[model samples]
Every structure is written in C-alpha cells, then in structure tokens.
Target chain A: MSERLLTVSSSPHARGKQTTKSIMTDVIIALLPATAVGFYVFGLKAVILVVTGIATCVLTELCCEKIMHRDVTIGDMSAALTGLLLALNVPVNCPWWVLMIGCVFAIVMVKQIFGGLGCNFANPALAARVLLVASWPSHMTGKAFIPVDAVVSATPLAIIKEGGDAIPSALQMFLGFDGVYGCIGEISAAALILGFIYLLYKKVISWRIPVTYVATVAVLSFCFGLSAYEVLIQVLAGGLMLGAIFMATDYVTSPATAKAQFIYAFGCGLMTVLIRQKGGYPEGVSFSILFMNFVTPLLDKYLRITKYGEVKK
Target chain B: MEIKKGTFKKGIHPSYNKHYTSSLPIEIMPSPKEVAIPMSMHTGAPATPVVEVGQYVHLGELIGQAAGYISANIHASVSGTVKAIEPRLMGNGSKVSCVVIENDFQDAPCENVEKYDPETVSPEDIVKIIQNAGIVGEGGATFPTSVKLSPGPDAKIDYVIINGAECEPYLTSDHALMREQAAKVAGGLHLAMKVFGLDKGYIGIEDNKPDAIEAFKALNDDSIIVYELETKYPQGSEKHLISAIAGREVPSGGLPAQAGCIVINAGTAAAIYDAVTEGKPLYERVVTVTGSGIKQPKVLLFRIGTNVNEIIEYCGGLTDDIAKVILGGPMMGPAVYDPNVPAGKGTSGILCLNRADAHIEDPSNCIRCAKCTEVCPMGLMPMYLGAFSQKRNFEKCDEYNALDCIECGCCAFTCPARRPLVAEIRVAKRGVQALRKKRG
Candidate 1:
C-alpha cells in the first residue's frame, strides 16, 4: 500500500519562484541605492522623511486592510515602497504632518482604495505627490530644495517664470547645485540620475519611458525657442529625472503599448513645457505625469500590439 | 521583398530555451504500438469517426469524417487494428472521442497517395483534393486549411502568406521543418496559390532564423517572397505579419480574406504538399519537445496519439522537479495535469518545466503598470478584464474587450508584478463566450 507521505498539489503543481514577496523585495533592494544617495545628499533629514513616510504608509495600509477585512499585505513591502517614494518626492525639511498626509494619500487613497498594488489604476506615489502639490501649493513648491553649501533660490522653471534672466547657472542646475529650494526629491540631479542608473541596472525599470521622456522634453523645449543649454538644464534639473525615472515609468500607471508609451511620454513633455512657459506652475512633472497616468489605460486601448496571426480586412 | 529588422515593443525575452534543441535536427521516433486519432483536434466541429471498433485501417486511410465546414478528417497514421473507440486527451487538454488502433506492422496499402502537379491543377480540383486530403493548419491552431483556402468571390484572395514566423519561444518545429523541408513547404505554397488562384505568395520568416532564411532563399522560387520579419513576439500573428510584409492593415475586427489575403502556417503548407502530392492525410506532425527542465530537447516527427509521457521518457526524462506539463509552447499552451495526453495536429511543443523554473507568485493587486496593456497583442485592456473577472463581473469583462484577447501570455510574462493575467482573462473570455451562447 502506498503511504500518504505528504499532501501536495499536482503539476502546474508548481508556481514560479517569482512571488509577490520576491518582486516587492527586489523593488525594495533596487530602491535602496537611491534611498542611500538621497540620505547622503540631504543628510539626516532625508532619512527622517523616508522613515516617516514608510511608517505612515504601512500604518495606513494596515488600517485599510483591517477595515476592508482583507489579509494584511504588509509583507509584500509595496506599502513600504509607496511610502519611500512619497517621502522622496517631498521636501527633506517637510513637516512630519506633510509626510503623513502624503502617505495617507498614496497608501489609503491612491493604492489601497483602488484595491492595492497592481490594481491601483495610477502610481500611488505620483498621485500622492500631485495631490499634495495641488492641495498645498506653497509647501510643495521650490521653497526648501537648497543643496548642501548652495544658496537657496528658485528652480529653473520657477526662475524662467519669474524671469529667464534670474535662472541659475547651467552647471549648477545640471549638478543639482541650483540656488533654488524645492521638494525632498528635486534638489539632486546627480543623485536621481545615479538612482535611475541603479534601477536600470537592477532591471527594476526599462529605459524606454525615461529615455524618451527626457529626450522629448529636451527636443521640444529646444524647438520652442528655449536655448539648447536651458533645455539641457531643464531636462537635468528639477523633478524631470525623478518623474521620468521613478514616477512616470511606473509600470501599472503608464501606457501599455510601445507606441502609446512613446506618445504618453511625449504628452508628458508637452504638458511640462506648456505649464512652464504659459501655465501657473513653474515645474509640471508631477501634474504632467499624473495627467498622463490617467490617460494611460485609454491610450493602451487605442494602441495595441497586434496579436500574432491576427489579420483583419 | 521588405526585410524588417529588430523591434522595440512591450515584449518579454524569456530565456530562449530554444538554445537547447534548436540546433538539433528533426528525428523520427519509431512507430508507436498504438495511435489515437481525435476528430476535434482542430478549432471547429469534431470530426465523426467512420470506422467501427476492431476495423482494420491502412496508413493514410481516413478513419474519421469531417462533420462541418470547419472540421477536417482524421487519417490513420499506421496500418493498424482499431483497438478501442473512447475519449482521449488531445492537445489543449480537451477530451474527445478518439479511435485507438494497435499497429499491425503490415503497412497496409493506402489509396491515391501521389504527388500532384500544382501548375496543371484547376483551382476547383485543388480545393476538392485539399478537402479530401484532410489537411488543416498545423501551426497549433489546427484551423481547417480548405475553408481558409476557399475564399469567397467577393473577398478575392490576392496574396497567400506562408507563416514561417514561429515567434513562440522554445518551439523550433517550424524552424527545423523550414530548414530541412524547404521544397515541401514551397510546393505546399504552390498548391495554396493554385487553389486560391492568387499570383503572389510570401513566406514570412523571423530574421532570427538565419539558416531557415538561407534555405528558403536557396530554393529561389520567384513567386515565393521569402521576407524576413523583425524579431518580435507575435510577429507571426496574421494581422501583424500582413501589416509588416504585405503593407496592408487588416481593418479592426475584420478577417484576412476581407483584405484579399490568406495566411497559412509553414507546417500547414508542408501538410498541404503531402496531401496533394502523396495523397497522404495529416496523421502525424512535427512537435518540439523542449524546456529547461527536460533532459534532452528535440523536434520529433511524432505520430498522433503517442502519449506525451512516452515521448518524455524517450527524451531522457525530467531534468528537474517537474513544475508544469504544458501541452504546447509556454506563451499560449494550456497546462496539463496528466502526461498521458496524446499529441495531436495542434501539439507544437510540450514544455516540461521544473519547480524553480515554472513557479509564478500568487497574484497580488494590480499595480496598473500597464505592462499588460503594452504587451497586449490585441490591444485589449487585460487589467480591467482581470479585475472585473475576479469580481465575477462578466458584463464589465465584455465592456473591456475581453473577447479580443488572444490569450498570448505576453501580459503575464511581462508583468513586473507576477499576476496570473492570462489565467484570469481566460476566465473572462469563457464568461463572455458563455453569455454570448446564452443570448444566442
């Protein structure tokens, strides 16, 4: 007689080694290099903001899961990532209340409210950033983005808005040594680029959106009469790198088709330029990405990769 | 005429497990003791078995009868004695009535097995011959070839596109066949052209298969356009290939014939060649038995009804702890619980993956990464379909174009979040299909 040694599911019988925990774990690991760089660039303040954001996000998520009577998904670290991203988007000196509110928006409103992680129709952190920007424009503006040993001033977009003559040096802007003060994530171009490179190396993100987004912005900005250097500075400065690499490239919130993604990124660029040149906001990466995120699904519907062997009249 | 190069789309390059068996040549397995011929191996109506139990059958003799316009006849692969008539697992895991025969080793005489002159045959004769030959698309879709060949007069088929674009990973059966049987494939194309009365025929092969391209080029039939396709997942898809090579955009929700074109798989073409030329019926097909977990990956010329387990055993058995026993290529194949499934006309690849290799994480919430959208070949929103299906909202599934999904696994493969997209979307498809049936 065959002994019943162990109860096991039969073939397919097996799940791939890639689980939610593993994917979330990989994402956290990929985000670490950038987190460390942010900490280094902004000192202990950056760490505090990140810790606060993570705490609130995790707390909000746990609370929501409990109320929803769903299994606690804190183990997935998705909440942690959302918190980290939200924290990264704000000013390093942002009050704990601001971080908490952003965390609530990202975790409770953007992510969990829509059914968590992949189900959330938009990138939680990006949405939260946009929400925070819209709700508290003064706080979200370039008020505290000063670099270590640099004079605090306006961002290039802000400077252009006030007067193009008042803009910071191209080198300073490129190196994130701008005289302006801004959000927690916007001050360090080098740090964000480094983070972007790390994420690329980790394969956490593909280069398509970031490459196309920055290229489109620079090309369009140049074609629209902005000096080539200003275009480069604009591309390198502010939240363009942050939004392009971290926020705009959010897999779920972006357009699905390649052509659609290209258009989405281009749309983001166009919106950013319009807001900078004519609209009220000096920098529009946050709004542009969030707006584009809303249209991603529709874009995907209209633009799709043809099914193999799928022919039509 | 136009050779498309590499592509940049939302596609995944999963381990090209093709590296394992792609270099291997096609080998004929010794004839099996018994063969099971299923009538419903193709996409449409199940064929009706003509022979009774205990009846003797010769190689190439029709054992099953086509029931409708979409069905194809099933022929005996070997001279055998009908052992049993019962339900058996055909490729795609569907249980259908199959005629089981025990090989008699006599190789009994078959009827009308001869090569035909494509140039001399009239289009009507070609159609009748194709119908009699029981040839169907053998590219795993198993669509009846004659019905596709019989283009309506209003929808004049101007071009015959031979799909050599075996875009699925790890399945090199088409590649191996194209490399080895170029003449047979081309002859099948000629037969297709004659039947359709179409002038131009293009063989679309992916640029990745250099050897296969060279082989077709050497065949040098001026009428056959050996166009190299860009290396992309689903480039072999009928619409994408037509758009890529023929420069004709299939109108949304339209058929290829509506665009004055007819597409046939390279394997299907070879079967057509055999059918008209040798008067042989489609009883056996080439299958690529491959995966990282298998000990030896190879393209075997397997007879229908040969058990998958027997083939696996012949292939040196499992290399790792088996995770999945899929009946076809991973992208579109259905997972099977039992390895006793008999190979059929549509059984292109049998992927045996081990635990570490085949594992996918429990699906989490959709991040709305749109990876599903980016990689979706049908351009349908898989996320909405999956989300709505999870809620059992079949109506919303319809609204999301769940019917448009080809179930190509690209959404699941490229998803950063390990979502069971294809599995969920399939539920939605079934739901919609059921509702449509209810309404009808």
Candidate 2:
C-alpha cells in the first residue's frame, strides 16, 4: 500500500462541544431577554441604539484587525458581545455619534489595542462607558434634554440621592415600569435576572460573582440606616443587577481562581456601596467594575491557590 | 471503614464509550508472520538484548535480560527465529533495540520455565515469581511491577489496592478482563496480599460497569473488599485511585508506599496469578480497539510484539475517514505518527479516531474563565499554569504547581477558548526540570 496520511496531535484527543464562538453566542442569547425588555420599555429608539452600537463595534474590529495584519477574529463574536454590552450600558436615546465613538473606543482602542479580548486590562464596554460619561456629561445625564417628555422624570438612584423620599415602591423598582429612568438594559431588574438564570443554565457564567456582589451590596446598604424597602430599592435600583450579573463578571478582566473571584466580586460591591454612599456619583456600577478590573492582575498574582493535597509550608 | 459514597472530588464525567467493546469477550488474535519485540517495555534502563541475530528462540524464552534493578526481563511472545536485532520505532515514538522475529507457527514452549504453588512459596519467592514473569503495570504506565511490589525498607506497605476504574473513554480492556476473568483477578489480588503479608485488599472499580462490579463483588469476602467509585475521568489514575479508595496522598516526588499503599491494575493482578500458578511470562494482554473510525470495535488478547497494523486489519480495517490512531486510552494515550509501531507493555487501547474527534481548534486567548481550576482533578490553576508556560515563566509555573498537573487534558477539553492547557504546562514542566538539572 502507498503511504497513508495521518494526523499527529497531543493527548486528550477530544474537545468539549463549546467553542469560543459558541460561548459568545450563548452570551448573546442570554442578553436577548433584557434586549427585548429594553425595546418594550424605551420603544424603537432602543433598537436603533443597539444596532448602531453593534454595527460600529463590528466595523471597528474588522478595520483594526485588517490594519494590524492580524487574523480577522471578529467571527468569534467577542466584538459583538462587547457591542451589545456597550449598548446596554448607555441610554436608549444616546446620540448616534456618541454611541459610535463609544463602540470605536471599546473595540479598537480598549480591546484591539491591547491585543484583543482577554488581553484587555479593563472591560471594553465599561471603559468606553466611562469615556463617554466623561466626554459628554450633559448628554449622558439628560440635563441637555431638560424636557419632561424628552426623558423619564428621574432615576430611582437620582431620587435616592436626594434622601430617598421620591424613591419608587419596591415592586415598581423591581418591575422597572412607570417611566423608570436608567440605561436601556439596566431598567428592568426582572429581565436582567432572567438573563442571569439563562447564563447559569447555559454554564456560560458561574453564580459566584453575581451572588456575592449583589449580596454584598444588599447587606452593606442595609447597614447604612435604611429601612428594608430602601435596601431592596438599593439592590434593585440603577445598574446594580446588570453590573453585578454582566459587567463585574467579564472573563477577560476577572480573576482566574474561584476564591479570588469571590474576593473580586466582593471588592466590586464594597466599592460600589462606598462610592454611592459617600462619593459624588449617584450610580456606582460602571466605576466599581472598572476599578475592580484594574485590580484583577493583583488578585490573580497574590491569591495563588493551594493545590489539592498541598501541605502547609 | 464503610464508604457512604466513594468519590474523589472535582473531576469531569467524560463520555465513557466503553459500550463499544465492553460486552465482547477477549479473542486472541492469530500470530502474525513477523513480530518486532522491543527490548525496553518497562521504565528504567532499556533492557540489554542477550540474543543475537539468526539465533533460534522459543515462545516465552528470555531474549532481553534486565539491564538494571528497575528494569524487567523481556521474553519472546512467538516461537520464532531471531531474524534481526535492530532499531525500530516503538509506540512511544522512540527508536529502540527491537528483536525482529519470524514466527514459525509452532507454539513451542521453553522447557526451563517453572511454576510455583502460592501455598508453598514465601513472600520473597512471590516477588521472584512476578519478576520472572516479566510483569509490569499494564494500566498504560509501564513501571516494572517488581519494583512496585517491593517498596523497600523505608515504606510500610499496609494496603493492597487494585485499580479497575478504567475511566478512559473508548477503551474497555480492563473492564472485560475483570468481567470474564473474575476468579483470576481475585486470585491475583490474594497472591499480592501474600506478597505483602497483608490482611486486607481493596479493588476500586468505577460504578459505570455494573457487570464488572457485580463480578468482583461475587469474589469479595473477608480479605478482599470491592468498592464502587464515582464514575469520573482520571479516576483510574494511580494517585487518584489510591486517594479515592485508601484516603491517602502520594505526595509530590513520592511513591504510593510512602502513603502505606501498593496499587496494582486489576489486569496486572490477574497476570500475577497466572505467573505464580503457571509460570507464564508477560507475553499477551487485552487491548480494546474501538472508535467511530473503525469498522469493528472489539477486545483482543494479543501477543506482545504483534504489529499494530495486524490488529487494525483484524478489527475490520480503518474507515476511510480516519484521521488519527492513538495507542492507549484516548485521554492520556500517545498519538502514533507511524503504523509500523509494535504493541508494547503499556498499550491498553488502539483508538482509530475520526476527523472531528482528532482535529484541534485554532486556540484563542484564555478568557480567564477558571473552569480549568473548577474541574482540575489535581486542584491546579491550569488557567495561570498555561499562561505562565506560554510566557516561559517557569518559576511562576512551578509555584502554581505545574508539575502536579496529571496531563489529564481536562482544562483544555473544557476551555471554551480552546487553550492548549496540558501541552503548554508540559513545556513548563520540561523547563523546570532543565533548570534544576543545570543548577545541579
């Protein structure tokens, strides 16, 4: 017989069915519930914002990869996931140019510049949100709109910032109805929670970060001399659910050990609670996650896991 | 001690494709026209070939003598003429001295081989019987069994453990061995108990094979206790098996006897019984040939030095779509680059895998998901270990217990990014060793 061809590879011949593309697709599927909810709450404007965010990010990623002579890995869906996340973190009526700039920065600058996906030192969406908030404060804060019909009256956190008197009822805050003013994805705690369950079921993400982060925020906010309803409001209000479930748990900027993950999530909750209670910001989710992102490398380095059957030195 | 549920923590449930060959009884393959027997089957110094070219050798005659204390003797599996003693490719992809023999088709036995009764033999004599049989661990780890049977003066060997976990996917040789030859397996365990002068022996079988478990349970009595382990990959790993059944840790750079345990394969135990009772050398073994790429999947009792090509053809030849063929269990088996390789002592399975099963994805960057850590049976942070390895950060890799990685491929298998976890960590281990050697 003529020499037959064969493939030589390392041991562990089989791989699990999940791929990077499949995992990113799972993340996209998990976000669909919140995306649908955002459309219902904010109408067609939210759809335009999402499509623009997705298109700009995907375009920016393709251009950057081509310019850098790198393999075009936009098909991995990571850029799409980043785009969806960036759109969810901004207002439904965010200006088209502002949204495009955020997408460009998140994809080309924050992610691609750092060698893409896992190499980024911070969450691309959160960093871009930070950049946008810093750049056009009035446009982001709704002060530029200044019309009762132009925007929802006040965010629950905005009401709580002025001593909690106008804070909506617990059920209303949880349902995120009656013109609840927040980012497109962050409005409905109920829909975001459904996404969280979907993520858990698909094994896309673990329960550690979301559970620990939310519990830390809820427990600490209760200790700030607020009644049970106000603490429930704090837990359900403004980006707390969305940030804890999605942003704080971004795999790229997170710790690589289970115990360190708990510590990282705890740090996020503590920072968010501290910043909300004492700092100038009314919502602390974005900055809290961003701050924790910078702390990820240190967490991974210092928190070396003691291996199984490893004896004490 | 009563086990409420026998399990070692944090392991993956890989698809145990044992069904392909588990029900089949062992059939001895017809002797090939030519057999290439490698001199080095067991670990340690490669055996020194005592027989020269053109010498007449009988079946079960010593052709290669043990070169060192840690090595085992090699015997001819077929009655044949020594056509050549030259270097040939072994299953491990190494060029070694192989005794190329032309089979005479006469199953002639050597007259000098002797058998001893277990009742009449002393503990010291029992070790000699195993050594004379040229038996080594058949669990794909070809450590000389005589060395393991005797753990030296420093170790107090209290427990005799038999490993029947066979947790690898697409291999069922050990399970079939245990099922059909339960009496031989039990008798072998008892002989090992005699060698160790031990009162208790435990056979740890993964609970997936109810028939094997039932067969072993039927032979269990006062001295022997069979425990059904939780079905998990790498559950059959020697250290993991000892830990799961004996509740002891063979520390890094340590032996099982250091933890008061002597672990043997259930197949090895049966081989020991045959050696002690009938003076049979380690010649033939059970091998499972199964995968989607094979036309037939079956277990065969094949003689050593049999060409892997003959075994494949006997299994109904390879399907046209076959891409890779592994020489052992899929999880830890070495991929053979050439079909000319012969079956050595450690080959327990021949997997003819399809393209989909054999293809490696273009690995993406590690997402730091830490699922590697979650499913690590060795409790290693493979995420960081792989990163450190790729960075050539050998020191950090060591600090993260890179050497402790059992190379089970769990991290890589579960990685959504498809990072080469085991392959990278293997680099770190080699680098660490090179560094240590340079320093020394």
Candidate 3:
C-alpha cells in the first residue's frame, strides 16, 4: 500500500521529453563535423591540444566545485563543451601549457568565480581566448599558422593586411586546401556548414543569429571593397563561419528573445567587420562575440515583444 | 465555405491519448454505499444545508439551497438517509462543508422531477431552471452558469462557443458526451444563446475528435456550425477558443463577454439541457477514469459525491505500478493524496498514472532556450518571470506581466531545463496581486 502512495505537486504532472543535459548533448553532436575535420586537418598536434584543453577544464571545474563546496555539475557536459570550444578557438600548434592555462582561466575565474554556467556574464571560452590574446600574444600568433606537411602559410587576413603574393581561389578557401592556415575549427567552411545544418535541424539553435550575422558581414564587407572576389574572400576568410554558427549562438551568453537575437547578431557582425578592418587583430571573431555577449542582457530588456491580445490606444 | 479551423498560435502538442476511453461508451456506475456532497461546489458562496441528519431524501431531492445569487443548489445523487452534515476532504484537496448520506440502494425518483417542453419555455425561465438545478461550468471551473448568462446589457454577444475541444491528454468525458448525446447538447447551446439574444452558435471541437465532430455535424442545425479546431493543448481554453473560432480576442484580464461571445463547455451544455428540459439536477456527470495504471481505463457516469476510492475499486482497483492519482486531466488537474477525497462538481477525470507517465525531474537551471517564451500562448516571457519569482522580486515579476499568465503550464511543460515555471509564476502572481491590494 505504501508503495502505491501517490505523489502530489502542482498541476502539470506531465512534462516534455527534454532536459538541459540532453540539450548540451545535442550541441556536442552538432559540433562533431567541425571538430572531426579540425583533428584531421591539424594532425596529432591538434588532437593533443584539444585533449589538453578538455581535460584541463574538466579537472579545473571539478576542483573548483570541491573547493567552493558546490554540487559537482560536470555531469551536465557544459564544462566539457566549454573546454572543447576553447580548444577549437586556439591554434593547432599552441603549447599544451598555454591551452591548459586558458582552460583553467575559463572554468575557474571567468566561469566558477562568477557563478557557474548561465550566471557567467560573458562566454567563458571567448573570454579565455581574449585574455590569452592580450597577455600572451606571441603564443596566439606565429607557428600556430603552419599546416601539416606544408611550409609556413600566411592566413588570408595576414596576406590581405600585409603585402603578400599568396592569394588562394575562393574554392580553395571553402574546402580549406592543403596549405591555407587558420585556427583548428575555423579552417573548413564545408565542415562548419554541415554542423550549422545539423544544429538547425536538431532545433538546438535558431538560424537568426548565424544567418543574420553572416548576412550583415557580407553586406558590410562590400562597402570596404567593390569587387565580388574581394567580398567573397572577406566572407570566406578567418573564423567567420565558425564564430557565426557556434559562438554567437551560445544560448546562455546570447539574447533569448527572438527580436533581441537579431539585434545581437547584427551587432556581432558589425563589430567583427570593424575589428578586422580597423583594429590591430588579423582575426576578430572572438573579440566580436565577446563584445556582444555583454550587450545581450541590455537587448533582452529593452527589445519587448508585443504580447498577444495586448493593444495600445 | 472554407471552414476556418480554430487554433491559437504556439501551443505544444502533447500526445492526445484518448484511445483508452474515447470509444468506450459511458457506463452508469451503481450508487456507492456512502456519499459526501460538498456544499461549496460552485465558485461563490457555499450552499447552506436544508435537510437535517436522519432525514430520508429521495434521488434528485434538493438537500442544500443556494446561499447567494452567485451560487448553485446541491441535490442528492441517491435515495438515502442523511447520516451527518460536516466538513470532508474534496478531490481538490480542500475540506468543505458536506452532507454525508447512507445510500438505501432503492433508486427512488423525486416527485417534483418531470420533463418540460423546451419550445414553450422563455429564455429567463430556462436560466432560472438551470440555476435551480445546480448547473455550473463543468469545464473544471465550476463557475455558476447563471453569472456567465448575464454578461451585462452593453455586451452584444455574437456567438455561443460550445467547447468540445477536450484537448487535455488521456481524458474523454466531453468527447463521449458529444458522441452519445449531441441533440441534448445542442438544445442546451440554443438555451444559452437565447439568454444573450444571440442567433448563431459555434461548436468548436478539435480535429482529433473526428467522431465527436461527426456527431455534431449530423445535428443539421444551420445556426450552430461544427467548427473543427487544430489539436493543441489549451485550445479548449476559453480565450484561445474564442480567438480561434470567433476571430476576436478577449482582452487581457477580461472575460469572453469582452469579445462579444459566451463560451460553455460541452459537458455544461449537456447539463444545462437536462436541467431545462428533463427537470434533472447536475447530480451525475460523466467522468473519464483513465491512465496506464488502472486495470481498466473507462468513462463512467459518476455520482458527484462518490469517493475516489470507490471509483478506483469499481474500476478494478489500482495496478502495482500506480504512482500519482490526479483529480482531473493531467495538465491542469490537482494531484490527490488521499483516495477518500470526494469528486467535486468540476471533476472531469480521475487519472491513476503509472511510474512511466508520472516520471518528473528535480528542477535544474534555466538554459535560456526561449522555448518557453516561444510556446507561450500569452506571449509573456516566462523565463524572466520565473527567475524573478524565484528570487522573490515581486516588482520585476509584475513588470514582465506576470498577471497575464493563464497558468496553463505551457512554459513549464516546454522548458528544456524542466524549471518549475508555472509554480514560481503562480507564487509571483499572488505576491504581486497582494502587493497591489495593499498599496490601494
């Protein structure tokens, strides 16, 4: 009789079949194509760097939870995703110690110290990358730009910024050919597109931010240059695809309102273009995403949706 | 004419599991040994007991009289001797004043009960008869029908919306009523429309209930059109139904009359028909006793004062895995802790769920998925409202229009984080209302 005891709560005894863990797992599945291509293109060095980043973040989060007397939430896979995204953002040739430091900074200072997961004001991965780029600029540039079985390759942004005779076809940039160099995850446009389609199909992320962000970049790029080839190069080059699809669409750090998401995306695109054209950095995806991460709360507050049946005289 | 299907935007499709009892015709249950009829069945003042203990009352005899203009009378469901008049626990988890009776097993009809010709009755007379017979909104609201009938002289009602959209999963009381008694239901619809001087009626049934829709279509009443509605949870809701069928919006914090319409539940219409024509009180209502945990899922014509335990025992008792016993449909029903609780006037279902259907998680953090906001029928952001409520910030919660929430549980059901959005928002709403009352 006790075993048949009825459980009582408020109304809505039934619930939909989704959880935060399932959502996080869906995100991991969406990132598979790009991560797989990254490991393939960058060889053992890429695998080692990614593993180091993931392991460091996981261990750092565990230690922080223990030290701060908080419940261990590594089971949610958010920390692991943070580790993986941070790993993808770094150069394939980044030293293991530098990757580990970035991961620890992300999980401990930028995330756990501010309160874990959704409580963090900015994306932990992007914050860690920005911090690394600021203090340890040497580790972020040089040597990381060399692909497997090729001589040192100048990134499209570097070649365009500095006078260089190395110009690759648009198809070469899309396919991420043998010698063209960038971050581990940002190399292949094809892989990122596959990942983007998967995310959209799974309903894990909407197309508003990624689609609008890319479209804004495409429109703003032509204002700086007139030719179609130059515009295509601008769109296809250096971290735009990866950043637009993945980082700009981070659920916690981005705006939750549909209208606010468009504003946030447009802001990200404008920041990326402005940074690339005028700022000191050759790649501007991380800085652009990080910049708009702070504006998400403001957008969510001010940009109101007209509620159903509500009217103004 | 292209039939415009009635539907509100952005509602989640929970599996409509009406198969268990949709086809099962309602079987009248034998009178239970003891009945405890709660006096406070309607929303207004509780009915005052008229019969003393030890008095023998025949079936359909009035035992409790309406205490105010906004209340309904209570009738005996069985020929019995009144054993006691005391407070008893009702299925809604509240102890209300009730008259406990000992059934004599002889189904003696009351002398005053007789059928009247609907064609000879005036609209006001029909409304008076319905009020005397204790007909309330049987759509789980139990608001006295008399109040809704008089929506004020200025409101020019255009249509009578008959709600047959039993959108809640696993309940088919109204669906069965529509299938078996369509003519009587339509008669009640006409009676309700006559009260408002309205000529047209719309019988809004979800497309999922094809048999119910077909039953209404066979009525051949040109004035009362059978409108098929899109199958969505809370489509049976008055605001959503009015919006879908009548193409008008009931303003926020307003009634259906604000949209020039009156919405009545299909069950309420059937009850009104019985009250007006057959001279019968709302003593027995068809209740769908269903879920995977029951040995037999069925729709039984339940006597109002019967206990949940008696119903469960009559339905072949509970299975070994039964976990939660709800008093109504799963979405908006109150969970019953004790089976001894009496089924109320508004009870539409008695759900005994097994562990598989009763599984729920300890709520976690919100991931800002915005699925709650997207699927919200009210268009209020439940995420911010829930967060503010959790932090006890009543001002912030009110600023986000927490008052607009219909408490439909849509946001809570759709949230990937499984946050208790509805519960927290309910708290916030109460707090804000209290604060406003204090300030005034």
lDDT against the true structure, each candidate: 0.76, 0.85, 0.86
A193-222: candidate 1 lDDT, tens digit per residue: 777777677566677888888988898888
lDDT of 3 by residue, A1-313 (tens): 3445788888788898777888788877777787888888788888998888888999999999999998888988988888888888888777888888899999988889988877788888889989887877777875566665666467788888775647677887888755667888887888888888988887888899999999888888878774778778878888899889888898889997889999999999999889888888777888899999999889999987778678557
Please state the CAPRI-style docking class of candidate 1.
acceptable
Better of 1 and 2 by DockQ: 2
Model 1 regions lying over 4 Å from their true place: A1-41, A55-72, A75-77, A95-106, A118-167, A178-180, A193-245, A248-313, B1-12, B111-119, B392-396, B434-440
TM-score of the B chain in each candidate versus the native B chain: 0.95, 0.97, 0.97
Across A94-160, the per-residue lDDT of candidate 2 in tens digits comes to: 7878989999999887889988878888999999999999998866764422224643456778777
Which stretches of model 2 miss by more than 4 angstroms?
A: A142-152, A163-165, B1-4
Candidate 2 clashing pairs, residues 3+ apart or interchain:
none
Model 1 whole-model lDDT (C-alpha atoms): 0.76
The sequence of per-residue lDDT tens digits that candidate 3 reaches over residues B1-440 is 12347688877888777888888998999889999999998899999999999999998999999998889899999898999999988776778999998999896889957677877788888878888899899988899988888888788889888999988999999999999999989999988888877777788999988988888778877878888999998899888898889888888778888888899999999999888888999999989999988898889998889988889889998899888999889888989888788887898999999998998888777778788998888888999999999889999988898999988888889888788898999999999999889889
Tens-digit per-residue lDDT, B1-74, candidate 1: 33344332345455556787788899998778887777778878899999999898998788888998988888
- Identify the runs in model 3 with alpha carbons over 4 angstroms from their true place: A1-3
